[model samples]
Target: MDIVEAVKTRRSIRRYEPRDVPKEIIVEILQLALNAPSAGNRQPWRIHVVRDYRLKELLTDAAGGQMFIMEAPWVICVVAVPEESASRYGERGRSLYCIQDTAALITHILLLARNYGLDTCWVGAFDEKKVAEVLNLPVGHRCVAIIPIGYAGEPRKDRPRKSLSEIAVFHE
Candidate 1:
């Protein structure tokens, strides 16, 4: 799908079919997602692809019983390594730039998944400490998002969006 189409149609799919997304396709999407721009090209993101049923159950619990996490065949945890960015740009890089960079990477993953006829949900409402422990994240690294990816179990309807005037500001 084209970028515009993907942007318009993408939804936070909460239900997934009982089918598997091929490993090659998942790797291809990750490869493309890495092209997302990073601050100072530091690429402060690390992706953890979780397919284990026990791990998914733990993730679901970490996300406060968001059961859809277990329905998808794959869950992707996007991690941010602040120290990597901080090495080049100092405190601001650690606090802000790394987060922004990983957010961009997450966006790439969502859109690229849609391009491959896969469905995903950008799940961010999880206990950070719990997720860190569940994923065995290194010290100072953070899990920015938990994405459940697979084929959709049901169709999604477009939700309402704010108009450009309500959300945008023109400087010139």
Candidate 2:
């Protein structure tokens, strides 16, 4: 699908088929995510792809018992490396751009996955400290989102979004 179509169709897929996604496919999707622009070109985002069912179940529990994470074939943990951002932008940069940049990269990954006939869900509601422990993240790396990816078990319905006029404004 084209970019516009992909953006329009991409939804947070909560239910996934009990099928495995190829390693190469996941790699390609991550590469696409890496293409996202970052503050000062620091590329402060890191991704942890979790495929083990047992670990996924553990992560699901850490993510507030979201069972869908365990059902999906794969989960990706997006993290913000503050040092990378700080090196380029200073203290304020670490606190601000690092997280936003990581989020943007994850958005790119989600869109690319959708374009590739895959489904993904970006999970932000989770215990950051627990997630860091679960993933064994290093210090200064903060967990931003947990994404579960696979083929859709159920069809996606349109989610209500604010109209452009309601969300956008023009300066006179």
Task: Indicate which candidate wins on TM-score.
Answer: 1
TM-scores, all models, native as reference: 0.98, 0.96
- lDDT of each model, Cα atoms only? 0.96, 0.90
User: Model 2: which residue pairs collide?
Assistant: none
Cα lDDT tens digits for candidate 2, 148-171? 999998899898899999989999
Model 1 CA deviation exceeding 4 Å by range: none
RMSD of 1: 0.8
Candidate 2 — worst ten consecutive residues by lDDT sum?
52-61
lDDT of 2 at 81: 94
Q: For residues 1-172, could you state the per-residue lDDT of candidate 1 as single tens digits? A: 8998888779999999999999999999999999999999999999999999999999999999999999999999999999999999999999999999999999999999998899899999999999999999999999999999999998977888899999999999
Could you list the CA RMSD of all candidates, in the order they appear? 0.8, 1.0
